[model samples]
Target: MVRSATTAEFRADLHAWLDVHEAELAPTYRGMGTLDEQIAQMQRVKAILYEADWMRYGWPERVGGLGGAAALRTELGASLAARDLMDPGHFSLVEVLAPTLIDFATPALAAEVVPSLLNGSEMWCQGFSEPETGSDLSSLRCRAVAEGDPSTATQWIINGQKVWTSLAHFSDRCVLLTRTGPPDSKHLGITAFFVDMDTPGITVRPIEMINGVREFAEVFFDDVVVSTDRILGSVNGGWAVAMSILPFERSSCFWQRIAYLYQRLQALTRLSEPTDRNAEIIGNAFLELHALRTRSRSTQHRLAAGATLGAETSIDKVLVAAGEHAVYNAARRLLHNTITLDDTVHGEQWRTEYLYSRSATIYGGTAEIQRNIIARRLLNLGDER
Candidate 1:
């Protein structure tokens, strides 16, 4: 299927549509809103866009989308972020998870669930990190045992725990990882599953962050019975599935975040009184953000051209974390005591964002881990010990 509009044309038309519908799309809460408010506002905006056909532009028609290059959806999201209609990180999750389903799930299953995600009827979470394993993904112990013969089993019973799963408590489904192989099998013996979160014997408890938001969760699966049909990719090929998601998460998903940061930077400028030191700091932050956007733009184009992204996106991961920290650090520097002391809604938002921004180096993948990937995979400088 072909997209009817050019990228620039789509951008112009989307902006015009948004201009006309500003009142309808505006959020009811102040500043960026709490996590609950953000989710509600995001879903409300998503449903409106889906209804108006704006949300369907980049996704395949088989998934209830109007087919086009995936980059078009990035444009949609960047625009929303620029205008403050939707949270960029929340909006970009489709790029991270939906494509995984399309590429790995049975066509019938992908067709059934992907539409629900795009239309704001369903939310999904990734279940990869564990309390014991952390970023050492191959050490995952969330076991899934076949109910009968391994080769022909129709049911698998899953039992284990997932920690730091973002929004698991609110998610309708999960793209989960399980240890299908032996305990010592490591990376070679995992599998991915598209499991319904409402299934019996599953529990979710949200984890409150330093920023006072319960954005992450601890999820437990106890003898949860899932059909063989729910496997995302081939058995023991979940390592491949895991690799496929990181590229999207680090690169494509970060584009709209760049837009969000740009907007926040502009807001920071408005709040700060101009000083010589402030000028230098904001200028440096702008340069770093520009670098991130330029690099991420190339990644989005590569995805548009159907290029396979691999360890190279670790560069994107590094830049996004760096850029995020730079922006908020600049905020703390320029705004000073306001960010640290104010208890007002507006001031609290800045303080919370500043706190959250500090964790950029830890989530998705750590800075040290990314630098190791860059050294080992991209630069070819390091030897494995």
Candidate 2:
């Protein structure tokens, strides 16, 4: 059995390991690459980390992890992001999806598949948002119906569309949400599934982002037959699964994103000349980033302590979006012509990142929606209007 270590011990050990293996883990292409290339690079890095046992820390033993506190995993991701070894967004998918699987899927199923995801042998995508149901997840229309008697059904037929599914084209499986109850049942009618991406009747069409990468995809499911054993959590209990995911998305995933933002801020400082305007911009951005990091750290500890996170995480979401915008906005202002018109590698990178940052508020629950959540759920204010 792998020995458990405190956060400090794990950090020191991981940093030393990274320092020694930097050459083997570093990406061949930096700052500029297609989405596929970036994904490949992330997988390579994950494979090496998994072999070194770093990726397994903080996860449960049942899921092939080393069974340390969840904070350990966040630190690993942060260290990687700080060193610019992996794209935090891509590296964070596991943090977003694996926990849901472990909590909701059957023990056997989780044990069988979570290891592949952890070890970099396969990639998975979350299938939640539909074309018409972005933030209003309760109104999703994806349909799943049992092909046999409800009590003994062995298969389910699913037909629906999911948009904005990150990394769908490269995924081996999907943690999908479908409406299994009456048409208007809303949240109560939903069910979650562990689906094979290669299953017949499933199609993935990549969508190119403003950043010039196909980071998102539209996934279509038509008459897709899935085994009953693939069900995650109780039938028609997908809302709970989705709720569980929100906290992780808003908190744990942001740890690495925060590290990435700090790296960008450092780069912006280095590229721009020392001027009052640049100084003010960087300083304001730094403050926002620091606030986000502090809030996110508290959330991580709450999660590690086994607290059930709910509307409280909306605050984290709002802060992270704000911090992301601030950092990239500063980059746009300081980099000036390079961000606007230059075609050099550094210029392209700044431009691409700036464009992508625009979606930070929109993804993982929009800033407006998060505010609504905070007002209605957290603050006991009136319903969202």
lDDT of each: 0.89, 0.91
Error (Å) of candidate 2 at residue 29 is 1.2
The TM-score of candidate 1 is 0.97
Best-matching candidate per lDDT: 2
lDDT for each residue of candidate 2 in 127-231, tens digit (9 for 90 to 100): 999999998999999999998785689999999999999999999999999999999999999999999999999999999998888999999999999999999
What overall lDDT, based on C-alpha atoms, would model 2 receive against the true structure?
Answer: 0.91
Q: What is the Cα-based lDDT of residue 138 in candidate 1?
A: 98
lDDT of 1 by residue, 198-277 (tens): 99999999999999999999999999999999999988999988888876787667988899999999998888778888
Give the residue spans of candidate 2 off by over 4 A.
Answer: 1-4
